[model samples]
Target: MKANLIRLGVDIGGTFTDVVLEKNGSSFSTKVLTTYAAPENAIIQGMHQVCAKAEIEPGAIDQIIHGTTLATNALIERRGAKTALITTEGFRDVIEMRTESRFEQYDLNLNLPEPLLPRQMRFTVKGRVDANGNVLVEIDKSEVETVVDQIAEAGFESVAVGLIHSYLNPAHEQLVRDVLAKKLPDVNVSISSEVSPQMREYERFNTVVANAYIKPLMASYLGRLEDRLCEEGVRCRIFLMHSGGGIISIQNAADFPVRLVESGPAGGAVFAAHIAARHKLDKVLSFDMGGTTAKICLIKNQTPKTSRVFEVARTYRFKKGSGMPISIPVIDMVEIGAGGGSLAYVDTMRQIRVGPESAGSEPGPACYGRGGERPGVTDADLVLGKLDPKNFAGGSITLHGEKSKSALMAHVGQALEMDPVEAAFGVAEVVDENMANAARVHAVENGEDLSEYSMIAFGGAAPLHAGRLCEKLGIERLLVPPGAGVGSAIGFLRAPFSFEANRSVYMKLSDFDSQKVKTLLCDLKREAAGFVRTCDEFSEILSEFKVYMRYSGQGWEIPVELTEEQAMNPDAVAFQVRFEDDYTKLFGRPVAGMDVEITVWSVNATTPSEKVEPVAATDGADTLVVNGARQLYDPATAKFVDAQVVPRDEMEEGQRTAGPAVITEEETTIIVPASRNAIRQPDGCIDVVTKE
Candidate 1:
């Protein structure tokens, strides 16, 4: 790595675009409202602002790393290109007919999420590939040409080819793509074997469809962004943050745009993991709240948990199987539309409910004075005196307290028959409880105890509510690191160039093929390494291996990590022992009579991570020096209190202040409740702990 290299990291959230410029070991950041029509406009705006703050020209920057929620938003809003899916004849409805499991088993009126492409848009051809990669029926060129002609007639911009058992054999899908390309050369194509290349036809098919769905949009956006940046005199390499918590070349990103889903939240998870490493915390709960969403991730041993498959735009909040599952490597987390812009309203039961819906940047929260009529969390925060009208977002956008009050009164107060302040309290309480409940559910699902973890809060809105969330979750320690407002953007700078490759080739313990396993792992390693090489050929690369294993009759598999030696010299007995150990830890015991089987194998290749030196724990000395005092709402007391307000940069290391205080910064504010005390750690992190 080059020392003192200037790099720019930009993250586009639902409501805000965060930009961080790191040059000469110093960091400068800025946040701007996201431009929905032209997302790159916001990036360029933020980039120029941060570049000015860093006292450097855009041309001086060495590299640009970006992450965005555009792909995810496009899927949720159904705003992508007119895409079609071409699959095996009999499996045309596989994506619609999901697995047998129901997210809400007892609800008679449960609504399953609709498939991305409608039935009319999905076309099929006559071809068959068996589970073992054997071709039962060769793909017919005439059939593929006919399907291509139909797709062209339908005006499809992109097509997804997902043949039955394509993960095992790609010949049939490749033939279809070849014919499609020959017949309709302008349309984009995505094949399941190349996109996912894993078992489970539904997930693989959906993954390819998603990739094709967003391919044209993302490709155009990236092209425009590059052109815009070049016009702004930025001449450097551009990389994209991927869902797997790594950086990939922009070309790679455009090709497999589905990998970029959840990229922004993945960066936040990476940020929390970095902080965890710095603090030497073994267990951490990462809480990131921005304008449009909140993400909760569990970090163990300084590494965020990863998943091979994660759902997007979940229709049923907190329900696992109620969303479209995209089988891609991703940083695991629970995301909810519970952010500053999350609209608050009263349900039929007269109970206040916070989002899944947000008044995004165009017409943001009522307090933003952006023509939003509905009451949102930001409006509530403003009404509750938790936000400074003149200081929010460095005063780039002024907030209107009166508007917030009126919105709250009209939306929530009237229904609940309460004053605006009381209604604001209700909105705030409901949103906070929603986040707390999400955190609890996530922790429980991971078999983790929240009490054993420290909370690392970031994003534009996390600090404002993290203390209250911590109090609710019974978490003792909270760390609000510097540049918390642009944490995800900064995280993009810290991410390594990496990629993960996975394939499914089943092997039972009784008939284990050591040579085949070795060959598979080697191939995966090479594939992953090839991707990393595109990003940085000179950087030393490292490989990590894992296998998804299960008992003979079980459907799902648990991931078991493996060493290079263990993977190369596969021993059935050793593999079973390791699987048993992990299964026992997860379920308390493993079945003794069942034989173990390996289903999917994975390899991750990456450049070296940035080294983080641990910060020594300090006993902060109490020194009450208040810069000012503000009338802040105390949730604990259910009333307003005169709380000391201090600028974050003004406090020295080891300085401590009691709760009922607000620590202000240019980007965000940290609210310390009356029951907790805030201290300045040596690393400039605001460490808040419960008062003894």
Candidate 2:
């Protein structure tokens, strides 16, 4: 919140660790290979590199805001600590018996994903809390103790306790935690009431289990990161980026690591929103393609769309209802396994299929010369001349073009009976089409048209492919902002301190009690504000209210936002009006003569967003800046074209360049497709637009 203070933003992705150091209003950044054995090692390496670039020591950093994909990775890889779950006696299989929804409805061989915890690992307690917070059956302390003893005998490092209806009456769940604390004090415990106080036993139980599964791993990493920073003479307070596009205290993040599952992509969304606000664009598509995954989100009114629940580790082609559902406040986006390091090979249909499998930094893309045999998206980019073999990562790492050619030939070309160049083209097009299709589907799901939206592309690999993606999606304008390669890390510095608290208390409008509604909202506000206060005690906090409402007999609900006055002054008529307005927008029209019901209430408390200086639009003189030329593969034409190569720093404000050009920066490169032109906007953003 103070000017001239040095701050550090670190994001650890599956393949790369990005660090940005901001000092005296200027920033320096660097990317390093992620160390899986010791993730913090990468952070330290990246931090030092940025510090050296800024001509400062690590000790000069006043604060650090970090986000990571480790938690999501743990859940995906199922390499977390050995964890057990305790639940109501009858609901032991809630997680395994997921709601009746099939991602693949007609595929009889649809292989359902295995639950996080096996039935043997999930022990049940004899306790019952009714829907109205009434105790139908008091929890037996002895039964919980017996379960705890079994858990200890089974050598579980962590425990999850999720009693039915615990969101209404957490007293039963607390007793189990108290018993665990007295017996297995070292074993970490996660309870549904504290982790996610929402309805639906399946999502609630799964969430707590996920939190418990990764709690120890995250806590250990955070502890080691703090110690390593302290060992380096850095005394700055540390914070963590959360999935809801906000910053939280490190302690809270460690306590509830599930909230950090989408943290990195969340930061990117925030960054895109910030850019959208500065450019005065209400409808923008956020495209973030990193080393391991690509995330696409839609921003309206400079705010990233938010969701209360999202799936993680979708086992069946990134389909809905195919992965473990995580119930937390998150930036809603569609993330697919398409990134620079995503591997490619010919499928059974003789089509190239790119990742959900990435050759991470250990043995990165084939072009990295890191012992990887399979060609990846990066390898394709290298073979296609989108990357410089000599100057990759600003010459920090040399790329081997021959290796890329060989891998592409062996993996894809040979199978498809094509040359290496054609194979590379196939791989690139497949990956780009995958991303484009994902963006289109996401937009359609939200009732939006891609043609009406501008694109904000970021992340390490996005700019290189964004132009072609724009072409495919029929998007007219694209903005590749400054520090685009490390946009998420930069976003950490721009986010506000905030937290969202959610509770599910089903109440039909016919039975709505205004006094009770006010009380419920107030309590949630306090709970969310308390978490934000732990991050920053001095900043003035603001509150946002939302409720999920649906007509009676509907399977799902739509989120309806409410102002402070409308929220505080509970009116059933007003609530119905708002709900119908949002429903009509989402669906074609609202059903008439149906009673509306509120399912979940959410309150987000956040500090004010940082003020931004707007950037004036720039129109360059009708001249091109052609510093040099190189052979670039044009995807639109499916052939090689001589393209201009211009260094980013040399492009002055309002300057322009024609299609088939490479606007190169130290961290990344922007490829202007044959159908587009590039403009250096006044704010250092390369604005790419359609030539027509």
Candidate 3:
């Protein structure tokens, strides 16, 4: 690919649709209010504006990489198509009976998240495959035909097939897929063996049901988007970002939308990982605050940490194990509904609370003047003088500060008997505290310490809150990288074309079958390589092998790395050594004499990533003076202080600006308190270091 080949990346968020165009090593980005009815409208409108600014034709675009929250939003909002779940006879209620644990033990009135497929829609067939992949009970072909007829009569849009132990032997699943195509050619079908070929029936079944539940909707939307782009003279290939911080073909995405659930956050992690590599920061915490959510991810050694299973739409205020569990490779991060467009109001106990609820871009925060009466985090930001009235979103939409103030006053201020400014601070503090609490809990749960990690801030609203968040978390430094406004969109350009193939087959290290393992790994590698070959132009592909291992009695498994040579040879000692190494890194030690068994084997075939170098420092301790000063409330001091204001672009690398100061940019502003001193890094990042 030539440097002049225009590469466009579009990310659809809850509040804004971000577009980034890269050409000849330079990038141009813009944000527009997302169009809820037709998301492609926002993409076209934003693409037009950015292309006009760059003076390029749409036909010149060589590739378009996209990431979106639409699939996730639909799953969370319960707006996907009516779906049916078909499983083994005894596992009809697996999704509903999640984990058998209470997220909030003391809260007696807690409501559980509803299953995506209701009990009435969940049907089962008489099929059995033993744990060793032996066919104990054969599937009745006539029964499958009868089930298909019943599904057609029931007016279902999609179907999920999840037989017990199907991950080990997909013969029954493949038969169902073949029958599905012959019976109902248009309806989409997803199988657990294909969607999530891992053990644990609950997670695997839920993942397949989720895929089937959202298949029709995602397929229709993606088809329409592709058609619309073709109509707009864009002949480039479209790549979709996956939950694992990589790019895969559109066909793969459509076939398995479960892998796309965390795609948006994965992009943010990729963005932060790139910045960390450029700045040579070994420990970094990526903070991304969009319109509807805030995400916190940890990066080390220039790579984001990845997890095999994560929950979605937690019920008890984002509590773990209280939501739908999906088994797929995803970048590990903590996400909360604390963003600019998150709703703010008085709760049932007469306490002020911010979302979990969001007034999205359609009828955005009251400050946007888009027919919304609910006060939001953005409204409070405007009320507190953090946002520029005229230059918001580059002046795309004029903000009404008074309207925001009035809405906040009527909804929050009068109830608390405080003035609008104090109330505004309250809203901001609550949201900030919510984010801090989430980050703290996530770090502690993962056995990580945040004090030692630097912060990488992005998204439209992250920079505004990053400085303050660091102050609260006792974090010493922060990096607000270039293209901060649309960081995730730009990150799409850096993703690699890859796919991971996983399968479940219980085999103890003591009973290791080298021949069987070699054959299984070879088949999975070919399957994964076939997917990557569709989107990459490479002569060779690299393979990564891993196994999910755990003690015999343990309920869950931990992933451990396996070498190509080791995967072909049977050696219990080597397996134990690798498992112990990984276990010690995570939990500080491994239990002795515990028999470890491999539950799932995963192989990822990938194309190589482009080389990225660290940005060099331009050394000089220059002082950038403020244009003016303003009285702003500082939470650490718990009082109002005079803060200096400086434009972010005007301050060059190596410039020092002391707090209390406000660093303003086109997309967001950074507020530094008197307790912190900011030094501009060589890579144009503001490293806000603590002062003694």
> Can you give the TM-score per candidate against the true fold?
0.99, 0.99, 0.97
Clashing pairs in 1: none
Task: Please say which candidate is ahead in lDDT: 1 or 3.
Answer: 1
Each candidate: what lDDT? 0.92, 0.93, 0.87
lDDT of 3 by residue, 394-424 (tens): 7787899888988899999999998888888
Q: Whole-model lDDT for model 3 versus the true structure?
A: 0.87
Clashes of each: 0, 0, 0
Clash pairs for candidate 2: none
- In candidate 1, what residue range of length 10 has the lowest lDDT sum? 618-627
Question: At residue 662, what lDDT does model 3 achieve?
Answer: 80
lDDT of 1 by residue, 1-692 (tens): 67688999999999999999998889999999899999999998988898888888889999999999999998898889999999999988999998867898889999999999989999989978787899888888887888888889889999999989888888888888888888899999999988999999899999999999999999999999999999999889999999999999999999999999999999999999999999999999999999999999999999999999999888986588988899999999999999999999999999999998999897999888879999999999888888889999998989999999999999999998999999999999999999999999999988889999899999999999999999999999999999999999999999999999999998899999888988999999999999999999799999999999999999899999988889878888889888999999888999988888889999999999999988986768868687699999998889999999989999889999898999999899999999989999899999999999
Backbone steric clashes in candidate 2, count:
0
- The better candidate by lDDT, 1 or 2, is 2
The list of candidate 1 runs beyond 4 A from truth reads none
